[model samples]
Target: MPGLGEIIRESQIWKSIFRHPMPLDRRNRIVVMLTNFFLHLHPVSIKKQGIALSYTWCMGGVTFFLFLVETVTGVLLMFYYRPTVEWAYTDIQMLRDVHSLGILREIHRWGAHAMVITVWLHMYRVFLTGSYKPPREFNWVIGVFLLLLTLLLSFTGYLLPWDQLAVWAITVGSNMARATPILGHEGPGQQLLTLGGVDMITNASDARFALLGAREVGEETLNRFYILHCIAIPLAVALLLAIHFWRVRKDGGISGPL
Candidate 1:
């Protein structure tokens, strides 16, 4: 009689799901790698040095892990927090005091900070390892974009608290957009671009207005940042991350040596 393992492998349910037997042989291994969705994200084989903890530092993995943590905790926080001026600050307080869910906010906050640090370190390690050369150049560009998205995610989330620090910080930060060349009212090229001899860029219509959805940071800014932090930026980051990982696999797995 066949063994228990063999019996399970031959079952219809197993065959339907896995579509392959145990990867005991090279052909089976190849088939398994290609057929599995998660496995396909990685190479069939990676160099020993590429996976070494000392060399890789596992920063990429840590960063991705923290992103997952943030996603989970952020969703939990959203159930309690409101995006309006009246309830936003009170909701945060409720999470901390009333519901005792303060740990979730703390975890999400620290995870965001950790993710930023890990992404920078990951890029630094890639540069030091010469991983951005030749075939990996395009992926490096993707990484740079991902880094920007990470920062944007953090910035947008900063205003959700609806506190003095959050409001003023966003005010100072958004003011910088007013200095954006050509697009900003106070920017260098604003005077040159005129519609019927009238300056097009103004305080009412400039990059700052576009960012805040108003002349200043208030209700509109709070709602806009809430949507961006919880929806827009995260979706964009997810898309870029998918491309980044695919490129890593296409560029011959993790970079190892020269």
Candidate 2:
């Protein structure tokens, strides 16, 4: 039998995984990188002095990691939750009372809230460092979209609890949607929805009806929101997130000292 070293060296699968066809110079750069975990974060090494060790509040990557954690925990929480008015609030209590971890939902809930704050802070940090310049501009735009998706995910989630807070907040929010330019009363966008003869500005046909599942916020609204919260929003966030991460790699990573 071949020695252990020979077996690993000759394994076609291992070779494929580790193979790189770069020029010698390019290959050496990659080798030096794969040899260290922390240095792998950069596209190229720089003088340690070049890093603004004191000024860089670089936590955007950390925020993204935390967002992933919240997404995973949120899905797990949904498995044990019901969004119907009758049981929705009770389910939250039950998840806490009877969930396998005893506090799984609590952790997920707070983690979600924390993610919102951290993402905002991450954006603020980038703005402070002037990282929004040049080639990084497009990445910033993508980051903004991810930020909005995070907020949407949070808003959809707030309704799943089906408590007084959830209902009233969604009611206020849907009204704000109705007030939007194309869709709201204030904009030219409302004209198309009037059905030529019938009026849409009226509550009967306005955007609020579909969103609230009735003329006013109630049970069915909560149910529809539950599906959106657990499935639709999560999927959108995932796709945008993949783009967000890919942009980081394409943009040459966090802006470093000149």
Candidate 3:
């Protein structure tokens, strides 16, 4: 037993593999306490009954479960999707036309809708519970941003089908971007485009250009939207999502009454 102990104690490989501190050691506490990046992310201990099933369940764990489900199903959908306009609409149609396509699409669509609802409810719960005071205020801001990103993600993806609804919805959604003020990207960029002799600045470079991938809503536009829908927006969302979770841990794992 002593020989075994020595081997375990001296094993650098073991230390590297098991980086987490020993569960109850005071020495481990000091190590965690001194680590800046992770130090403030967790309390030293928790009450035995603090995380009761009722308290935890009342919040939105189900919503997070839906997010994971969407992630898995989305990845599967990726395999069947191509970003080109020619293929994008077709792929979506195929999802419906094929035997299981209907099931997959509904699960993905409904899952997205449910995720939005659940996230909102989650924030509401946190607010009602008075969890956004002081140290957690910054995290609350981050959560709000995440909620917006989630909605944007849904909106941006809506146009992939190239159907009447998708086209019109994005057509309207993007028009709002056009009307935003100079600092909002309309005034300054628009004036610059006009000076450059781009007759239809909308055709040359604008919200439509960015969204459609070309001057107008043709093949190129769909392709661009597909890229944003599948890749760019998701990456941005994921990065912010990481920060959101990290801030939660840092802010003492949700606030309580002072």
Candidate 4:
């Protein structure tokens, strides 16, 4: 005569998947937290002030939420986008003007912008609260790398639209790599790098060349950026983010008072 909820909880399928009973008691709650993947990221206990809205501003959580939104919307956008020069711009136009889910692109765009801002704000908050001190210092460094990755994600995504502004902005941005000291042909120490008395660094072999995969930004540039935006950079970010969160839990949860 057990209830439906109880019957379901007792089923073999449920137990196999969950591996633990309902967290109705303290022991069960701890066991659940230890066993579950997502729940394991959080500490068993957190300071009251650590979670207070006024203290943390919840920027970190918001940044992570926006990243999730970007992932979903970006995936949806990929369905309608073609990275080739011929179809790239046209595909973007169709998404913006012709497709039923055109708004998905807009959402992804704004979410990227928001994620950048929130990550900066989150870093600022951590600095202001002295959260970057001591045992949390390593995690702070991780956060700094995360901030760079966030900006890289934005930069890589900017070109997917294939608009004039996007192309020009990337052109200007990528040009900065030409001044990369020893690695760039136009950089400071290029003349010093010689192989058998021949200058090794040139327009054809430099940091910018590596980035664009050619001397100029064209089909290859678009393809490279598309891969970075859709795959390589996201994978790196995801791996770093996993470490960042795990370090947070290990560093004694969120930063409390000094």
Candidate 5:
């Protein structure tokens, strides 16, 4: 006779969802991993040494966990947020006061900074162990991109509060783009853009202008940054993160000694 576990596995709901029994055996284990969405990020087997707390420091896993925290808190914060300049600061204030959702914002903000630190530490550990070699080379490149995206996610988010500090900070940060070689008004080689007595790369069309959406920071800048922080950049980062996780699994799990 079938065991109780087998009988439960045969139930309609279990069969429809799991389509397999608990991973009690090697084949079932592999099948369960391959079929599940979350489990697929992990290999069916990993180097035992790689999982040691001292060796790996668990930095990568911690970074991913913090990302999950930020994503969830960010979504919750969005429910009370308005991207418009008129309502932007007011909304954050409301979160702090009326809705008492300030903790969510605090968690999201600090978690972002913490994510940056953990990602750096994770890369450092990988480097120390020479894990960037051979089959992991492409994955290292993906990590580099993910690091950049993490910084960008932080940068775009800095402007969302729409306060004087946020505005001025982003203004100064955006102004640095004006020195981007030919693309910026004050950048090197900009002298070459005197074609037909018209400066092809003037302040009107320079990087800073494009970033702020005007000559100075204002509603448009806030709106643009909000879209980028809340939607575009996060979506891009999530896609890159998925690719990073998949690449980790494909490269034979976490790297360790050969």
Candidate 6:
């Protein structure tokens, strides 16, 4: 009879899962990467210069890795989190004191900060290397959106703890939205906005109010930020990230001088 290894290799389940043989040769390696959804995001072949640490800096990969880490740890933290004003602070306190889940929160918090730093470094590296030129310009725009999403995610999560620190931080942050030019009521041209003789923009209806879901940051704000951080922003980031990867392949893979 054939060996167990051969039997397993030839099994229908294995074939279905892998769709190709082990990449024992260059051709098979390319075939394997092209056939797999995850690996397919990367090109079948990469130039030495494209991957060289001194050239690319690898900050993009690090930022993406930190994003994934934050997502996983954030989901785990959600199990013990409550977004209500009454329960939010207590829940965080319990996680810190009783449940020993402080480590997970620490990872999420520190990972968020790290993601921000890595993303900026990645953008700076791209700029320094002139990777933003030509076909890579769209990818650079996508990277900018991703950076904004990272910041939004961090901002939304900041209020979940519902502590005095969190409250004051978010209050100050949201207040900054009032100066967002046309979208904000307190911006320069608020007097120009009138609908049927009534002002369309007001403190209660402006950007800050929309962000907080009320005049002040409270239970409603917590709930809104929870939904945004846990669902909406993450979904948008995932979709954009997929496109970002596909575009990298479409743009002839990672850019390098040679």
lDDT of each: 0.91, 0.74, 0.70, 0.91, 0.87, 0.89
Worst 10 residues of 2 by lDDT: 49-58
Q: What is the lDDT of residue 42 in candidate 6?
A: 79
Listed in order, each prediction's TM-score against the native is: 0.88, 0.76, 0.71, 0.91, 0.90, 0.91
Q: Write the per-residue lDDT of candidate 2 for residues 83-169, one digit (tens) a residue.
A: 777888898878777767648777777877888898888898889878889779988888888888788888888888777788889
For model 6, name the residue pairs that clash. none
**Whole-model lDDT, model 5:** 0.87
**Which is better, 3 or 4, measured by lDDT?**
4
Worst 10 residues of 5 by lDDT: 39-48
lDDT of 6 by residue, 39-78 (tens): 8777777787888898888999998899899899999999
| Candidate 1 residue-wise lDDT, 67-161, digit = tens | 88999999999999889999999998887788876889989988999999999999989899899998899999999998999999999999998
- Global CA lDDT of candidate 6, please? 0.89
Please provide, for model 4 over 113-156, each residue's C-alpha lDDT reduced to its tens digit, 9 standing for 90 to 100. Answer: 99999999999999998999999999999899999999999998
Q: Which stretches of candidate 5 lie over 4 Å from their true place?
A: 1-10, 23-31
What's the lDDT for residue 227 in model 6? 100
Per-residue lDDT tens digits for candidate 3, residues 1-258, read 469866886689867755655536887776665554645544556654446654444445576577677777888887887767678778888888974755777798898888888888888877877778888898888888878877877887687667888888888777666654432235454554445574345444555456556644567767776677677877877787778778877777745544
Q: What does each candidate score in C-alpha RMSD?
A: 2.7, 5.0, 6.0, 2.0, 2.7, 2.1
